[model samples]
Target chain A: MPYINIQITREGASREQKAQLIRGATDLVVQVLGKNPATTFVVIEEVDTDHWGIAGETVTVLRERARQGGAQ
Target chain B: MPYINIQITREGASREQKAQLIRGATDLVVQVLGKNPATTFVVIEEVDTDHWGIAGETVTVLRERARQGGAQ
Candidate 1:
């Protein structure tokens, strides 16, 4: 069984979008790795911006900085 | 950089537990794979029972069956 985990910031993604992600990920693995869809597992994880870090800074801080920079 | 994602059913885990998971996973990667903890990412994903499946049945259904079997 092949397990694929997709991590994204907790932006407001709809259930339909999540479903599409699950389907697309499964399809890709099946196509590229010849994995069986029945046994393949695709999980979508929505992480809070505060908990997700990048380059030693959390996404919350990074996004705020970007917004301020854009307004300047 | 090493990325580790841990998936568990949405069973009301506390923030402390999640933190422990993150720390433990990062330490494991550093000790075993010799990855830098600073660049190591650990994400904990809590999934709904309905969305997780095994043997063609969702975890929701499986847990219910287990409870019923225990009562009988």
Candidate 2:
């Protein structure tokens, strides 16, 4: 069984979008790797802005800086 | 930051169980990979038995067979 996990910054993702992602990911794995769709699993995780970071700065801080037009 | 995703066959996992899993996984990643817990993300996904399969048999079928004492 092939398991695919998708992580995104906490925001709003409609249920339909999640369904599309799951379907597309499963199809891609089946097409590329010949995995069975019945056994393939797709999971989506939403990471909180405070818990997600890049360049050693949490997303919360980065967003705030961006909003204030501060230097990167 | 390290992201950990755990997949399990859905049955009955309490919120407390999931919390412990998240905490333990984060700690393990920090100790082994030296990842920062503040940015580390741990997510758990529960897959339906029908959606999880091994050896071409779905977990649902396997469980039913086991309950009936059938050959694996």
Q: Pick the candidate with the highest TM-score.
A: 1
Off by over 4 Å in 1: A1-8, A11-45, A49-72
Docking outcome class, model 1: incorrect
For model 2, chain A alone compared with the true chain A gives a TM-score of 0.88
RMSD of each: 7.6, 9.5
DockQ of 1: 0.10
lDDT of 1 at A8: 93
Writing each residue's lDDT as its tens digit, candidate 1 over A30-60 gives 9998989999998887897655654334556
Model 2 vs. true fold: TM: 0.54
Would you give me the overall lDDT of model 1? 0.78
Roughly what TM-score does model 1 have, to 2 decimal places?
A: 0.55
Global lDDT of each candidate: 0.78, 0.78
Alpha carbon deviation, residue A66, candidate 1 (Å): 16
TM-score of chain A of each: 0.88, 0.88
